[model samples]
Target: MTDQAVAAAVARRFFGRQRELKALRADIERTGLDTLTGRKAPRARVLLVAGKPGSGRSALAEELADGLTDRYPDGVFRARLTEPGGDPVPTARVAQELLAALGVAEPPGAAEDELTELVRRAFTGRRAVLILDDAVDAEQADPLIPDDPDTLVVGVSRGPLTGIPDVRPCTLGGLDAKSAIELLTAFTGSVRITVDPQAAETLVEECGGMPAAVVLAGGWLAARPKASVADLAKQLRGLTGDPLTRTFLLAHEALPATAARILRFLSLAPLGRADAHTASALAGCSVSAAATTLADFAALGLVSAADDGQYEVPGHLVPLLRAQLEERDRPAEVQLAQARMLERTVRLLQSCRAVTEPEGSAARRKLAGLPRALRFPNRAAGADWLRSRQPVLLASARLAVADGELDTLARRLIASFVRALAAHRGAEAAAPELYGLHRLVLDVAERRGLHRERAAALLNLADLDARTGRTKDALLRYRLALDAGRAANDPYAIGRAMESVGGSYQELGDWQRAGDWYGRALAQRLARDERADQARLYGRLGAVQTYAGRYGEALRNWRAAAAGYRRLDDLPGHARALSEAARVQEYAGRPEESLRTCEEAVEWARRARDTRLQAALQLRLADTLDRLGDPAAAGLHRAAAERLLESRAAACEIRSGFEKD
Candidate 1:
């Protein structure tokens, strides 16, 4: 069949709701537009459609949106306010989705209030229809409502959404018998229904006028081309209790065992949505098998396929499936499924890090054994995968922790997430996720009595705090990490904590305390023969000394750092040390010495191919030359610095362009 023909066949037929539709239209006409102002009226008009599950509230709202497409010329925007499992969707997430739909670009970590304000501003003068489907309560719908009078918002929930004001409430129960029969005929074809009109009416009555039940029954009948309407009616009569539940059971029971098992496993998936990889992980099957099962379920009306290749079970059926799963009492099977999913996620995250990390790095080597399906084709695909799966990955971590029996998996998941995010999005962009993961790891470590892990988590959190400029908090956390490290007898952790503590003090302008901590860390590094760390600590200590006006001591430390880096064959480290020494020389009123040091630093930076460092050294050289009465040379250096900076900026822009794609 043609795409248009299929769409027309499945298109929602508005049946037996003329009164509700009329009332909704009247509400929209009365308050949606301000005739006097010739624009959308101020203060949004809300039409609330409240009904029981499967009562077609969302379908009704969509029908209304379709009818008013011309009135709201901007567009009709829709957002699901609840997950399929009936959890209220986080307002921040919903706000982000709406902003994206409105074509507004927001930062990845934007706060809820910021996104809400952005949504409001986006609809300030626009004429549009905003549909909040399956809202858990008024609270979930409040921030999403546009304040503009011209735009209309239709909120569909199971309750009245009483807390929201200026709402026109419409309560829906079920379709009348006539409309239900019509709906069935629309699905089963007019010829079949006309052949047995009485049986079709009996089937509609048996469905209790619930549209979802009627549709599922019709889909069942449509799937069986030779079955008469009497056959379905007789089958319906044999079932007892809620028609919807009975209908759901009938459809579920007809599935093959593997498909049925996959359906149950999907009940445990977050948001009731599963892609092929997720299905494979849950079902212990190949990706192709899982994909085929999901497609079959979609065809059976047991699930819906999204445009992005995700299949979601209907929200109303999630509870039923979960109840059935609970009754099966297969704890071991459930745990196995969870483990498989967690393990797959960890492996995928590892592959994400592998593709994004610098080539030939240890991290990349660690990910060598992953199967082809789990590995991304390139860094861009890896980054996109990480971005798309972040929510489900985070949900998995939360679920593992809550299960309590999967503490080890929880810790690994958190660590893998942190590493993958850092590699793909950079440290600053991934700071928030890192912060949360570190906290989770700390909890898990304490519970598992893993002191070393606890210490590492503390240090990681402190590093993030310092990076984000929370010096006092960083200091406190660093001290705690030091204590944990000592308790764990980990010399490396202790050294790292001491260095971080010193850095925090330096940021707070306490040079004396910074020097003491840096000295302690440097001693440990020296004792351990950690030459690279010692070189770094020398540069750190020299900067503190320079800040405290001990220029002579600072110059000595910087020279020692430069010599150590030179011996280590680290050109960038040597150049950075020379730059620090030059600053100390200038502070000590040694202009000629500082100029020579700056020149040497610039040459080393060039050898390292560090354009940014070269530009910085050129500026420093220009200052030194200006002080030494060489205006002509200073001008040349200044011009060189500008050109280098421009080139660096252009390179950064080009890299950013690739990242966006």
Candidate 2:
């Protein structure tokens, strides 16, 4: 069938989206209404049909194009941005290609705006439909959209084109059961469907209303002439027990031997917003060869254009590809190829995250063959690379874990990415990301029975929990980590875990236990000559003593902390020492010294931009003001404290001493 014919056929038969189609039609009508009302149309010229890899996005785009065809007389233009292997074609190339389709004679150049203006002019004064298929994002597709009032540009993509603000995004999801069944019946004989109606219905349900899988299942039954629909359903159940794979195998198995191997290899290929280079590497061929293979797959509806030159497996086909990959009993050659595939992606990840400062020759060897783009030309480029590849990095970690290689690689990947992310985004901002990484790291470590890594992961997780006020859970995890550290005979880890456990106890108002643990942690720090850390421990110990009304002991510890900080020459630690000592003095009714200490703390705070320290000093001044009977000044300081607390909750060193349940 011709491309346009197929696109038209796909549009006409779009099913079970009566409500959604109406909403889309209504949106389209609104655009027309604005023109008729002689008012300015919404500045948004782009119509985005956004959804995941599958969920019938192309069909929706085609339907919208078909709906607008009679109104658009200039001509309908369609461009595919992804190749079969899910690689992204560049925007410049796509824009140039799109212009060519619009009958514009123009040289592609570095000037993006000039090209955009030229493309917009081609469709001027004529109503037309422009379908931008398999777009990577708005940056890739939005440039091609016409500014003309008569043009309707529909972009199909796996995710939101967040870069565009005014584009009316019509998000598509999976097919409903009725549509899935109808899709299945289109391929399978109706006689077979009606003979065992219940089984066919069950089969459709099993496909999760994913049209591709349903059609594939029906296709498999079509090839098996004598197989009853019930029998085929059972066979499909055994095929992968997943709608995605169940259908993928039905079609993949029908391929010639070489193509099937290529398909499975493509399945294991690093899927991301990829470029032609990765797709070529996956196909074990040149870029042109991979491009041709991608075109073939697009023709078969098994792949789509993800971007200008990128091709991808249909989203729903991923699971099936994975299933097909796992089922094949391959020789060492194939296994080596797969390992190389993984290594290539690992290189990409290292370039994107740049977490591992090369530890040895082997690490360097593993990363040597990466694309130069991964090296990041500048710091801004590196930051942008990490942001651009974040999703791919996460998917790589998950793929490794799912493939039972977590013990070897996934833990390190999670830890390295987690650390990198934390460094880029300060801990307070990245708390949620850190929590997920800790969970994944711990799981991999436990699965591999690597106690040291497990303990480290547990400690990190406990810290997040404690900071979030889940001290009880934090206490339990910190103890577990401590036990693991002890089992490994690691003094540094054990000491740190002890301090974490103690901190949790302190938050729960268990001063005696907090003192004990802090003492132990301090002793370890002293033994290790970690004076900087020791000073912080002493401050924590002093705060617990003060909160328990042991003013003298608190002063002794605070003074010791002050001496330690002075020796270490840490300004922040020095400020904390002064603040704690002042609080202890105030509790002991030495307001004169307390007032002097708070003044020093405020001076240090102003230099440091330590709002928490300023808040504490303000509260302390308010307390002094109360004792001296200065009502208005005290109330103003109290209000300032409240505002600071609300604005800087995470940065503030809150004195939380909740009673244990």
lDDT of 2 by residue, 1-661 (tens): 5432342244347667666667776776564545678877653367778876556788777877776757776677888787444667666556666765676655312246766678767877768888889988777777777767667777888877887755677876668767777776665547887888898888877777766766566656655668787776676677755576666766676776765666666666545334444555555666566566555555445655543455556555765566566778465645565555555555555554443344345645554555554454444565665665564566566656666643565665666677567655556765655665677777777787878988998988888777766788889999999998998888878998999888888889999999999999999998999888888888888989988889999898998898898787666677778878988898899988887887787677666677787888888878877886887988998898888878786444343323332
Error of 1 at 515 (Å): 4.0
Model 1, residue 407: displacement in angstroms? 3.1
Which of the numbered candidates is closest to the native, going by highest TM-score?
A: 1
TM-score of 2: 0.55
TM-score of each: 0.81, 0.55
User: Can you tell me which runs of candidate 1 are displaced by over 4 Å?
Assistant: 1-19, 32-44, 63-78, 92-129, 144-152, 234-238, 256-258, 346-390, 413-443, 458-480, 508-513, 548-553, 589-619, 628-661
Q: Write the per-residue lDDT of candidate 1 for residues 1-661, one digit (tens) a residue.
A: 5322332456435677888999988976664335555764457889999998888888899999999988899999999888777878889778877886797866433468888989989998998999999888887789878888878999999988978876888999889888898888766778899988898888888888888888778777766779998887788788887988888887777777788889889988866778898899999999889988887666556676766677777788898888878876398999999888888888888888889777788867766666778878789998887877776777777778768888988888888888888888787766666676787888888888888999998888888777766779889989999999999999989999999999999999999999999999999999999999999999999999999999998999999999999999999999999998998999999888988898999999999999999998999899888888999999999999999999999999999999999
Q: Please report, as a residue range, the 10-residue window in candidate 2 with the lowest summed lDDT.
A: 652-661
Superpose all Cα atoms of candidate 2 onto the true structure and report the RMSD in Å to 1 decimal.
Answer: 17.1
